[model samples]
Target: MPRPAIHQSCTKIVATVGPACDTPEQLAELIKAGVDVFRINTAHGKIADHEKKLKAIRAASEQVGSPAGVLLDLAGPKIRLGELKSEPLQLDIGAELTFIREGEPANDFEVTATYPKLIDELQPGNTVMLADGMVALVVESVSTDRATCRVTASGEVRSRQGINLPGVKLSVSSMQRNDIANAMWAAENGIDFISLSFVRSDEDVYSLKNVLKAHDCDAFVIAKIEKPEALEHLEEIVDAADGIMVARGDLGVEIDVAETPMAQKRIIQVCKEKVKPVIVATQMLESMHHNSTPTRAEASDVANAILDGADACMLSGETAVGDHPIKAVEVMSRIMRVTERNLIHEINHSVSHCVHPITTAVTNAAISIAEAIDASMIIIATRSGGTAWVKSKSRSSIPTLGVSDCPATLRRIQLFWGIRPVGIEKMASPAEIRAKISQWGKENGQLKKGDRIVFVTGSGVVEKAHNAVVVHSVE
Candidate 1:
């Protein structure tokens, strides 16, 4: 039997899959280096391509003897440019540009959009950001089928780059036809997590959940907090979704670039209070796409995210289509491990007023006990993985194990900070748990004769809520 890949760091790393590390061998290298979760960006690839990546991930997981969660990131109703007549068309300052609807006659200076109704949505003076905010255009005139604009910020524009209309209310549905199809495919493919991009409200999260429910898929729904509307309804959206992702790419474009740092901190703090796993994503190691190492500022950005209470920090281009995919994961893991060393006395989660009071109390007590005894490890026996989540939020420095029988639950908790998902027989009695963990501990060399272990479970409770904490000595 292969041993589970147990990581020492509390914060997790999520790496996006791309041509750089799509092979099973490359993925296995990433898994061994330290990747808690793999993100499949549905925006750039076909369903069949993603299917191949999924298969490679599964094979790599087995080869590495570790479990990694899969995140199916749905490309929501994104406004983007269509094929450009000239590749890498440079738009200088004060240049005139015309954005036309699909199938509309376009000249060399004119462009068409993937959304046919894009021209209709445009009005005079509306700001249009393209190529991830590198190029900016202000609507000068709106004619039938075309919106003539003047380029305020000039940069090279490419085919299929995203277009952002900041502050302009879009009529597009949050859940588009492609999103639904992708969600269906994700559910059918057993993706552990499905993230809805550009989530505007709790209803958007619920809508994705409903789709999964209809398909009998229990994959966790992650709401990507990118739009301004999502921030307006942050609390409700956090409470609605299974998890949250601070998607800072489009978010930076949608909101002021100056506000994104504070916004990222705010989102992580909210998830911490709400006890939902939050991932900080986008350009954490942007320069690493070409360079062998991350810039100093990028390293601090990643470390600060962990310090800000983010459960995980994600790698986009650094691991996807990068020159150093494995190196990026290794560097990220190293940063997390180093940053965590300073969080030994981090604040315990104060969520008594929120949901799962009983489970929260038990996990809280378990953390205190572990700290008091300087225990070697904390063991959270969970059924649906809620107890583990609570313990994870406590942010205890002690190494912890989330033991669950359900395969789905085990995979889902991979995103949780500080708590490693370990498969057990089932939620068992304290004695049974002790025996199993004792065997595991010794095999993994995590426990010895005098070592102490803290266990949190719901053995006495008839309901699913955890209500017990026990301390045991390895004898």
Candidate 2:
């Protein structure tokens, strides 16, 4: 019998690439440490550098015999201040500054902000937090390239620090020039997924999808929900997008810190309820950036996200340029393995019977068959994730095999709850499919003669018509 490639415990790790871990060899090390996905943040690196990293990751993946997915994160519609004599602008509590739509200096102490639509959204008394919320200013008046803002509170704003203006949703969409460029790059590079930063609504998802379609890229579009405006239309966004990312970094900046934990939990539930992969990102292992070890609280946070049904957790600064990059991934993988052990050894596992009627019906049948026969395992032959999705939505408390003809199916299915994808493809015949199932069982130690196993799959190649559950005995 053979072992499963990807087993239960619904936690996956995504590592960001940067100056810290850029080489092919280093990426191979991260992949070895169970980093399921790799992200290329175009916000920091050049396109050529990203292309080089993509090639490096591909070579390493080939060397390791597993296709690791690459995610390109776009620079969202970022409104940034113009150049300062020295950034980290020091201001008194009552100082005033000018924020403009143009990209130039306004005066000796004032500077233009560079987003064409910034002034359009500015309003009197509108609160704008500067440099990741280190400072706050209230809008007094506005013009095309300039706005008068009185310092509501003052603090240092360093170079390229993030600015957040909540309660003033921009009139324009969220896609930025960099995002357009990144989406084009994603299409050209054959990236698996494109994560849109600072997505504010379902319209943003549609806008990006339209762009991807224009470029003829079938890559999945994942909306990065990091704004309050994005939260308002979350349900629609979930429906429009293939996946959702709980981007806590900017989300926290835009919303109160005290509300963030509850918001995170809520978004996780929403994505789960929607049957889309939800990625919990930003500072999962922030301490790993500087230290060799993770805080107990951070480890617990990761575990909690897993229990909350987060399909994947992402590492930003930790993997991007952390001092202990590989170590960070290793730590996270260890955490996932132990957390899964805890679930299997103590907690009961139930398969999902997803929301769709057909999936629910097939899932119920699978569970009934499993219970009546007391089967040890179930085999699900799937493409496009529907078959496995049926098993996932079923809530069956047994080891399920997600066999797929496409490797992307295998990798993408990694985020599904209670699914372990075993890559196998045969276009021969039904007999061949059955033989491969048995062969897999025998090779993986899951199938033995007289053991009853439930097989879930569609009879033909009608991708979405996943409505068959065949019970068979291994012989």
Candidate 3:
């Protein structure tokens, strides 16, 4: 039997690139520690900073001999406060504050918001949350010029802090001006995935997709499920986007904090049923940002996400601004490995529900054959990476290798669960594929003469369709 080239765990790890791990050497270390995808957040940094980070990621990926995918996260329409009269404004319980429009005249107790129309949307008794729900206020009165809110939860707030209205229906476009510009930049730079923040509906996903299409970019658009509306339209959003991310940060604030766990499970279940790759993100190992080791509860969170059938787990501040970025990736990989060990038996029972009927049948049969024969490995030759994605959805315990001639396809499949993208130029024939696999396996000490390998491929017989499965033995 051949050992897995990149990893043994089925669940993938996505780490954000930030000041903590900006250089090529640091990024390479994280990749070597088991980071499958690097997320570049466009919220904090400038375009030039992100460009440099992209170059560093490519260099690091080449250094590690792995095709790591890049996820460019766009900052969607985020409602925030403007400059405050007092920096780090402290609001006391029962304090009355006025929220005026951006250009409205205001006194010490009156505040202005970045969204000029915020005052128009506020109603009496609406709950307003600020600084990621640290401060809370209940709307008391609304006039033409300003809305008065009584502080329900007292906390410190700074300029430009986010404001979340739980159930308020505000007239905000899904894709803001900054998001459109960032999406265009991502398209031009060949980002493997583009994640839109605060996606509220399938239309929101389509909005970003339309921009990408106009630019002739095929990068997968990932819809971030952060708002309560997104949960209501979850099915349609999942169907519309290429992937889903359980963005728990704002989601927890938008909905009740207590409902986040169940919501996370529901999102994962929906993605699994729809055969879309879902990433469980936000604070899986938050404590690891400062500590070298993660707390037991954090480890359990990561484990439970894997147990919930998430294709990938993401680290935000843990890897982006954490002091221990490399160690965070290592710890996350360890948790995934242990969690997957317990699911090996259950994994073989997974059935893929793919849109393509023939590809689904071929992938399912290939998994059954591999498990029946106890094959050393499963190799999938894919064109658009759909075949390998179907195989990955089946959750086969056997180590699977995804071979693609297209460079973009190879990079894109890096995020698929249980599929390791292997670089091979042309695997057009069975004899050639077998020889290449046997030679590479032997060189890597992954296989010997008697080991068996299963090859599933479309072979360009039909465009973007997989229709064949061949079982081969190592020579």
Candidate 2 least-lDDT 10 residues: 345-354
Could you arrange the candidates by TM-score from highest to lowest? Answer: 1, 3, 2
Clashes of 1: 0
Candidate 1: residue 338 lDDT (0-100): 93
| lDDT, residue 377, model 3 | 90
Q: What are the per-model C-alpha RMSD values against the true structure?
A: 2.2, 4.0, 2.5
Question: Where is model 2 more than 4 Å wrong at Cα?
Answer: 1-4, 7-9, 100-108, 140-145, 150-154, 340-360, 367-376, 393-397, 426-453, 459-467, 471-475
Evaluated at residue 378, the lDDT of candidate 1 is 88
Residue 125 deviation, candidate 2, in Å? Answer: 1.6
TM-score of every candidate relative to the true structure:
0.95, 0.85, 0.95
lDDT by candidate, in order shown: 0.85, 0.75, 0.87
lDDT tens digits, residues 249-292, model 3? 99999999999999999999988877899999998999988999
Instruction: Return the top candidate by lDDT.
Output: 3
Candidate 1, 201-225: lDDT as tens digits = 8988999999999999989899999
Per lDDT, what order, best first? 3, 1, 2
Which of the two candidates, 1 or 3, achieves a greater lDDT against the reference? 3
- Candidate 3 ranges beyond 4 A from true positions: 1-4, 103-108, 344-355, 459-466
Q: Relative to the unseen true structure, what is the C-alpha lDDT of residue 267 in candidate 2, on a scale of 0 to 100?
A: 92
